[model samples]
Target: MKCHRCGREIPEGDNYMHLGETLCEDCYLDIRMAVKACDPWAVHSATRFREGSGHKGTEGLTDLQKEIYELVKGKGKVRKEEVIENLNLSEQEMQRQLATLRHCELIKGRKEGDKVYLILYR
Candidate 1:
């Protein structure tokens, strides 16, 4: 069977049905935890954790996470699409990574005129 969300071919009995739509595991998870770029609680918690941990500036991040941070840091500000293309990440993958980075207080989204840009936090 083919997944309704991503069009990937799923073996029988391995597909997830969500809201009457068939989805692969990855797509289902992505839909379940939709990205929230402007979550104040996430920011506050991340800040508190960072202060308590004493690890500064991407010291305790995964390799991929650090790469994302550096990309945003070097560019100063970048569009979401640019990150996706540059990192060769799927939309869902990018969202998941971005959410984690945001929760860690490493990156944030900013609106300038008609576009949203990703920039390093602080």
Candidate 2:
């Protein structure tokens, strides 16, 4: 690949820039830093740096577990049976997902009045 700005051949694994047009790795970083430093407060006020992990860690969850996660997230708190009905999953599958999420520390809660309310972990 060629850097559109410098017309230099871009090496493998080299940073590719997308500043109106593609640029070399070094030039791209320089431009990015310049823009960021131009207004330090604008960049620093976010309180934290967020980056995409690309569902890498999420791959550990099974299909049922992912469904349960989404269900709990949407509903706030749900009983074990509600999940089964909403997801059309077997009791065994629901229990499996619940166990996986609990083991992974992704959720926390207990039972009350024969109903199990699952609280999602942030």
Candidate 3:
């Protein structure tokens, strides 16, 4: 079987059914715990954690997080689809990573006309 969300192949009996859609474990979790970038509490908690942890300015980011940061940094600003295509990331993966980056105040989203773009945080 294949996940309806991410389109990854799943072994028999390993897929989960949600609202009549077959989803993989990752997709299920992602849907259940979707990130909220505008939550002030989360931003405060992440900021406090980073400050106390002595990790500054992407110092303790995972490899993928750093890669995403660098990609945005290099581009100045890029459309959401551009990052998705450049990194070959699923939409869910991109959202998770972008949320982390946003919580760290390392990146932000902007609107120009009808589209949103991601850029390094000022």
Candidate 4:
């Protein structure tokens, strides 16, 4: 079976069902686990972790997170939809990754006119 969300092939017994959709392990876990960027404790924890580990910029981010950062950095700014399309990620996945990056103070959003774009935090 193929995951309904990510379209990855699911091995014989590894598929999961959610709201009538079949999902792979990764997609299932991603949906089950979510982190909010606006949580003060999350921000504090990320800040403390980065400072204590001496990891600057994108050093401590996941490979995908780093890629997202680089994509934004390279472009100066990009719409959320553009990043989601470029990375081929679900909206939820993009939100989670962007949350982590935002918590780490690596990326942020900017409003230009009526549009919001993701850009490096400075």
Candidate 5:
């Protein structure tokens, strides 16, 4: 077969490659190593947020808020900043969501050493 990119004759049993593109083992290794050397945080930042949801259009969280609720479970209390950092939410957004959670009796918040901690009531 011939390499699509370089048009070089690809040897037999070299690599199956991706259909039309006859990517050799060396090329494949280079691509894989390049990917491995890139920052994991950059890769994570690209795909952490799932797309295609009604919640994407709305300010109110759908499952992400519930995810935070579940995370705080078992732990008696957690700091507001910790929740904000872990959940990737802003302080104002977390405060609003916490208020809703409190209204629903799922969590309660109080001042602890000048920092607010939310206690999972459920």
Candidate 6:
């Protein structure tokens, strides 16, 4: 079978049905288990991991994370839709990356009237 989301071929037993769509394992997990940016424990753990590993600034981050940080830093502020469009990212994937960036305290969200913007934390 093929995954409805990414059009990837699914192995016999590795397909998942979500919201009436057949998805491969990765796509299924993307929709079902988005990481949250507001979990205090997550922030603490990410901080300790960075400190323990002596990582500074964007050090130790994934390439995608660094790219996201750079985009936000360069733009000053951006909407979620803009990031997704500019990076060609799925909403679920974008949320996961954003959550990680937030846990590292590299980015934050601000509400401006009816819309929210992503910006550097400091």
**Cα RMSDs of all predictions?**
5.0, 17.4, 5.4, 6.3, 17.7, 5.9
lDDT of 3 at 84: 88
lDDT of 2 by residue, 1-122 (tens): 77775688888778475746777876676455444432434323321232243342234455766778877878888777788898898764565566556655556676788776887876
TM-score of each: 0.59, 0.48, 0.58, 0.57, 0.45, 0.58
Off by over 4 Å in 6: 1-56
Worst 10 residues of 5 by lDDT: 52-61
lDDT of 1 by residue, 18-117 (tens): 8999998887777666444425565566557769988455654567778888899899999999988888988878888887777667899999999999
lDDT of 4 at 110: 93
Judged by lDDT against the true structure, how good is candidate 5? 0.60
TM-score of model number 3 = 0.58
Residue pairs in candidate 5 whose N, alpha carbon or C atoms collide under 3 angstroms: none
How well is each residue in 36-78 modelled by candidate 4, as lDDT tens digits? 3234566567667778888555654678898899899899999
- The better candidate by TM-score, 2 or 5, is 2
What are the Cα lDDT values of the candidates? 0.79, 0.63, 0.79, 0.81, 0.60, 0.81
Top-TM-score candidate index:
1
Candidate 3: worst-modelled 10 consecutive residues by lDDT: 31-40
1-122 per-residue lDDT for model 5 (tens digits): 76565566779888656545667665555445434433344334333442433232112234766766766674668887888898889865676566555544556877878887787764
Per-residue lDDT value at 2 in model 6: 99
